[model samples]
Target: MFDYADLLTYVLLVLKRAKLPQHENTRQVLRLVHEAAAEQNVPVRLASDLSQKNPFYALLAESSLIQALEIFAKGAHRCA
Candidate 1:
């Protein structure tokens, strides 16, 4: 089982690859991460868990907007 941080990293990577800018929803995303983590009975946060080598950060740094869009589209379908 991946940690909340790892899962969050995955989500962030996927979102970035899908090309959807997160905008000012960091707090909301954090809340959702907290809720999701709680449901899994684990506790973690973005600031606390993220390290210098965060894969999610790498993806964002590269800023592949089109890829981010695709990833997000798939995610949206799943959620819907």
Candidate 2:
């Protein structure tokens, strides 16, 4: 399986690049990502290129971002 920390870092970087106003939900997601990364000790892998066509890139809406974070959290737990 892919490394959740790396994925979280990637998502965090994307959010950083977005330069969007920080809403509470966004802050929560960021907090979760950091917590998850600290909890999960997975080996690092080379970063994979995300295609612009990916659904994630297309939908940066809050709902979609929350759902993505939820999935990552679940996956991280399973890995643990």
Candidate 3:
């Protein structure tokens, strides 16, 4: 399994990729998002529906977002 920083990078990639307009093909991005967020139980498939702008930056509600954070953070601890 990847360490936290690696997964963090993956999460960032997912978030950045989600910003593209809906008309654009996002299959690959979504797949990465699923892979990155799967462990955390974050809703990756629908995350692209969320805005890339201010307020509610993630498609996940606050609690699920926290879970994703925890998942990444735990990875960090494992490497320490």
Candidate 4:
């Protein structure tokens, strides 16, 4: 079974790997990402790569996983 906390941890790990500090905003972003991710039934791995496809790395470099998850959920909802 996929653990949500593990997934969230992985997101944080990736950010830290990219040299993002664990600041107040960073925690907020993680929480948002967690909530958005939970809404989409998104798995841990996809959550990790959700921003990897951007040519500008816009999502990965700027927006947090929560924002990406929100976009994913919105699109998924619209398509459904």
TM-score of each: 0.24, 0.22, 0.24, 0.21
Off by over 4 Å in 1: 1-22, 40-80
The model with the greatest lDDT is 4
Against the true structure, candidate 1 has what lDDT? 0.44
lDDT of each: 0.44, 0.41, 0.44, 0.46
Q: Mind giving the per-residue lDDT tens digits that candidate 1 earns over 1-80?
A: 22455565646643444232353556644555555545543344433323223223223546677766775665432111
Tens digits of lDDT, candidate 3, 1-80: 33344344455665664343342336754665666556545444444323322112223443575665665564422211
Q: How well is each residue in 1-80 modelled by candidate 2, as lDDT tens digits?
A: 34454465456654465332233345544554455457653233222222111112222444565666675564432211
Model 2 regions more than 4 Å off: 1-24, 40-80
Q: Per-residue lDDT of 1-80 in model 4, one digit per residue for the tens?
A: 23454455556644455343344356544654666546645444434433323111135556676776776664432111
**RMSD to native, candidate 2:** 13.2
Worst 10 residues of 2 by lDDT: 48-57
lDDT for residue 5 in candidate 1, whole number 0-100: 50
Greater lDDT among 2 and 4 belongs to 4
Ranking by lDDT: 4, 3, 1, 2
Q: Residue 24 in model 2: shift from native, Å?
A: 5.8
Task: Check candidate 2 and list the clashing pairs.
Answer: none
